[model samples]
Target: MIRVLFYSAVSFLLTSLSCSAEQKRALEYTVSFEHRAAHYAEIQMVVPTPATGTIELMMPTWTPGSYLIREYARHVDHLHATSDGKAPLSIQKTSKNRWLVECPIGKDVRITYQLYCHEMSVRTNWVDRDMAVLNGAATFLTVAGAESTPHRIHFDVPEDWSRSMTSLVAVEGRDHTYVAENLDELIDSPVLCGNPVVQDFNAGGVPHVLATIGDSSLWDTAKAAADVQQIVARQQAFWGVVPYSRFKFLNVISETGGGLEHDNSTLVMTSRWNYRNKEKYEDWLSLVSHEFFHTWNVRRLRPVELTQYDYETENNTRSLWVAEGLTSYYEDLMLVRAGLIDQSAYLKRLSKSIEKLQTNPGRNVQSLSESSFDSWIKFYRPDENSSNSRVSYYVKGCVVGFLLDARIRELTNDARSLDDAMRLLYQRHSGPKGYSNSDFAAILSEVAGTDMNAWLAQHVETTDELDYQPALNWLGLRFAASKSEGTVAETKAATAPTNEAAREVKPAETDETPNDKREEPRAWIGIQTSDGSASVIITGVTHDSPAHEAGLNVDDEILAFNRYRVNSRTWRDQLTQLGIGETIDVLIARRGEIRTIEVKPVTEPTEKWNLKPVAEPSDEVKARLAKWLASQ
Candidate 1:
């Protein structure tokens, strides 16, 4: 056992450190998906060793590519450790994080645990009747202090499931055989359990697979493969090489949201299975391209600070704007080259980003890097004040990427482009190389033959607003800004419309509902309860809300509204039937403590997230449009 753990560590450090960005580490493994009734499953890991120590096992608090610390370890359960056969050593969670064990310092150890995979979101793990979906980082464990050691993961995958496909470091043969160079390499690999609906093809001398879950009935493979190929080819051409011999696209078909990247593949949560709409289908392909671009832009080519990741702490960098935004630039570019989208669509996409950037107030407060760094604190846990205080690197970063592309073209008289800049960086730092704010400027200056310091200082670092007019004029376009709102029709009881006429009246027919306007206060009850079966379950109570003012706490089930029996889900509708300042007695079920309380409703919480149609399509918009139209 000691020898096994020690070998795993040595393999990881030796292999991962020696490889360049252009090279890929091998991964092999077998995974078993046990359908634990209707929700979640059980998984076990048998890892080979290189050189071990007192290995402390841990699950990443968050995924690297996602840019947020999701506290993944919180859900892992019943973890136990074993050493070969030496009476299975005991492993206790030493910190809030790692599992500490005093064993044969350098050897092989097998660990097992039960995971509660109940969530259906793409970001969460779910082991249900159909299959089990696990992100490599979420399921794979690491050697406490030996993160740099090389490793190989062997899975006791069930034989019922045919095979799995991923760009993760692995080779074909036994279900439980693959290599990992280091902790980062291990974390970078994503594994799929159960049947992965795969479509195999190639681009730039490497194979590509669109491995999706559920069904693949609606996929337009003819148009898809070409666009996908172009996506990889473009990035390959830019970097002058394809880092991995093979790549995988892990598509977790759902009904909403996006994806995150990894070393050789990407994990995407989308609406691909029930995909019926043509618009949605093409859009999904674009998303696939977005993540694929990151294989180089972010996963490999990164800001110097990102070369080595600190899974336990914040690894901040300003270049994410470029790493991510430039990747955004190519999402469309690949669509164009592949003919998946055309010129009109490409410009439409860029124009939309322009409009988004123009209207956001956060543009005036936060810089791109600030948004990128604060992502851990702000991006994932978005709430009411998010918009007024923070900006998105995605929005502004795309614009800067566009502007940089144009600048590169203009400076070299159309002879070179930002593509050259990206390629140069990839080749130079393909192996653990990084850049600083200064390093970034030097690179751009070298490629453009001019100073890009001022441009970046204002746009990338400081809060100085964008000079849209000039940037658009340079690309031959226009800009506009307008207030957008949210949907009001669906909320029959969310709040009492201050406008008496609006009491019974419905929301306007416009596409968007009014934004978080500081309009007249309607009424806020300050209780988060879901109405169900003519009753309400009080999930939480804010500090001074009418509910809290009167007295309320979480886990209290509401039995009635004003003595009228009403369940949790329907309480809101019942409230909208009444008017503002209306005082009511609430009935609830709390640990057998049946109680009634007086409360008044006020205005709802302030506006936070906003999404609207594009209004400003700038000069650089054409590139984006071409990509979108081509995707179609």
Candidate 2:
């Protein structure tokens, strides 16, 4: 009778299951970070439901948009776990990236682990004496079985720290931490910290904050604030609307190549600017403006394929050049509108980037869609042949932006431009349901009153380089093109090779195009790594460098270079002994595999060392250029 009762209960439970093949379960977590201990934090999680299947806990190998897997899991330490607040739950490492947590099959499990985390990385969990820098997608731990279930993270921050910046949904009581309903949202958010000097101001009657760093006082705060204020104001004035409730400017105090945009905030890495270099300062202001404009463009006003971002794969869209490139054009235009940059400087910047794209080889290998789609690998982790294999969507896209804008202005008789297209995009696809590629072209046609098929098919789809002549002529501008090597005589030339058997000799000389192939590489590549201490480790062997010919191998930590003791203070002294072709005996430890390789240095450098921008301004171009300048 008992067996009959059990069978009936099992049948009823099975019949009651939801029609939807239940997506896994979620693990709830509370993490407490103490600033006193630089690299330690406590994490507690309760895994509920779907206990029968194996769960895979993962940390993202890389961040979105910024390609390159850093293997973030290597940094985690002391990860002890449990079930239901009790010690000793069975967990095993299944792979470098996965952990299998064994529980009573289908049983609910609770866990807690203390992570010893320490790294100054922007995309991983970092806790220092200063503040915590958390990128949840790469740092948070999920149950192996609950990777699909909705999860939560509650943060506990040190009381003395006043401000934190992120767009994540914050728990009501979590002091310094935030939450993500699912893993996707967690991947998109990066939390900023360290008593961010918060300043609130109004733009277009909407509130925004310039979350300055402690070193922010170095700049003329009033000018920086006014720059952003007017850019926002001009955008609102043009679009006739403001999309965000508030905006945050995370002014990080680091030397940077550029800024990345977020929904309500922009994480900008930059150093102190000079009050004297007003022109350069204005250029930077335009950079900040570009990122701010992205809030509407790529962030909300997105392509259909990009609407549902899959953190696991590339979010490719054919329209990024339009989205990002158009934004770049507007960023400068906004500066012109705000009277920050003169029209001439603005047009010159545009002309320069356009010329660069047309001259690059990679433009032939990749289309705009392919560029956007493969950005996860190509755009960020550039390589020796990257210039030959890819084109920056930023450079080429902006050219298309200029041509489209000019065409729109000329076609509409100065009444409308890309700005109208953007406003329409904001109206139609601003809140969810991003625009499709076809929809964008339709809008362009509506504004211009002409079919943009040939232009789109040629420049956007096919690898045909953009022809900016007709567009430039529309504004009575004369396009310019020049090639002269003598213009940059002051810049160092790429050294010629003394022998034929060495590395490929850099080009002897090339045409005077800004995108000319003769520029020097950006770094010195001889196989050596530095310990935080005085030790110099031979980490790699260049193919045909003096080190490779001299028989140097990997893991051979250096002892001395040319008899100079390579202590911390004497490191630079050792590097001086090996200037291009000057050979010296290197003493090293190849993991206690100590050896020496003597290499001869050549008189000519093995590489090019610097790059300069070439100018090609011409005559008929001068008139349209004058009008553009006058507009600014």
Candidate 3:
């Protein structure tokens, strides 16, 4: 009897779910850009009502991928509701992001509102005379309890607008309509409308589109599409599977910056002139690679805390070090693997990341986990003391990923690495089920063939200094020697050949003089300054440095150094003339008052984070390095 009752209950649950899905399919949204020049998007949503005589409509407070409570409802204006028969209904504000509607039971309600879309960002909405970029979270309002229903959206493109683009599945036989499986899918897809230069390509047997939105006369669309194709193929090879049937790269060349990842598409903003410069173009490619990589890391195989998004509030997690940091580590590496850059370029980029992490004092104050957890409060909202109190999960995570990769290779006798661990983690916990920290550590242990929990704890959960020796040794790499006379051990370690067959690999010479050969160290005040109209303005004072100790503050305009007038161009040169330990009077304007502060110059810290190939490397080590960097 009990078994029969259980079967009956299952049958009833399935039937109810089917009915709910059917009811949700009734929800339809229509977006029109009637006032395109004024940057207002008219939104009309027809929602199916529940058995209750009242229903609530809500707008998300923030978008995913970009972490911040943006309060999207603030953009909504002049909202009204009406019954399906066109009869007016009473709507009242229930909360900041919700609206209560009194409607007839079992009747569909039509909600109409105007959204101000002047914010030009990847996660928000922007509409002008020429173009429109709409993010779902910042544009749509859905019925409260019917979020799981299929949401169909129709775009009423302006008559002059050429086209509209989105990753949402198109409705058959409809002019400009698309359908989403649920609210999550709706929010994950962004729409771009205008006459964009569309370049289509295929990767891993899947269709992909690159829609460039701004001026294209100077942009190389063909070359960019081809490079992006290479990135897609390489990343697909790394993951060994193509998760999305079709993908889109929404490249808005609107003189902006940033990229937000979606499941089947990515919205990236950049300047129209980025393609002209080699370094700037490479940076754009890296941004593309970073966001595309998220198709697997954060968009799918995300931290359990982020597995289910709470759009109204912060969804905190301690594993962004893996989601964002590991992704950062692989972004540039994947670029090299895709043949977009050479090993030297890759090494230079990696060296910069190492330099950034090593030079940051906050690395000693904040752990990787803490950095990830406090990102909502600290990372996005930065202040003057941020550098002294916090570290970027992205930078530190990238360094740790490098070290972890090398350690895994060492533990497994060069047979396995972090790549293997990531693949395994994805295989086990890809869909709705997300992995925890212990699960990730266990995967790493399995791949490395050893216990890695303690190491992981030390690097992720505590503020312990990271040991870079193991990775350097495994890859036959070392940091470049500085002039401070303390890099002898490093130089010897890099130059000492172990056997007759070992080849000596000297550091590449550049135009700059060798640090060790310089006559004297440069003087530093340790205060970053910006150019003001009349004087140099101090932007930031390094913690515990000479400038900080001298009671110098940020925003102070420096009128003179050592009683001599100085401008932005001559301030650094004048400061450099001062000898170390020499006390100098700095004249500054503090909120319109003149003051003089005595500051002693100090020897600038040596640059010890530049990475280079070891001076001596065995054939085995060279082979390992080759394998690590070789194209897949």
Question: RMSD for each model, in Å, please?
Answer: 9.8, 12.0, 7.1
Q: Write the per-residue lDDT of candidate 2 for residues 1-632, one digit (tens) a residue.
A: 00111212323333322111244334567767753375877777777744364455665666654545566667666665555556466778877666777666555566666666665444555566566666666667665434445655666666766667776555455565454545665666667666776667887656677766545656776667777888777666666656655567766654443676766677665666643367667767877888888877887788787776554445666677777778877787778767777656666666557545643557767887778667767887875455557888787777777778778877877666777777887778865688887888888888888997776777778776456556645554443321223334433222222243223221112122222343532112244444476666554444454555677666666787777668644554346545644567677777556667676644322222122222343554455444443332
Consecutive 10-residue window with the lowest summed lDDT within model 3: 501-510
**Candidate ordering by lDDT (highest first):** 3, 1, 2
Question: Which scores higher on TM-score, 1 or 2?
Answer: 1
**Looking at model 3, how many pairs of residues clash?**
1
- lDDT, candidate 1, at 235: 56
TM-score, model 3 to reference:
0.91
* Number of the predicted model whose lDDT against the real structure is largest: 3
- TM-score, per-candidate, Cα-based: 0.71, 0.68, 0.91
Number of clashing residue pairs in every model?
Answer: 92, 14, 1
lDDT of 3: 0.84
Instruction: For residue 121, give model 1's deviation from the true position in Å.
Output: 5.1
Evaluate all candidate structures by whole-model CA lDDT and list the values in order.
0.62, 0.61, 0.84
In TM-score terms, candidate 1 sits at: 0.71
Q: Rank the candidates by TM-score, best first.
A: 3, 1, 2
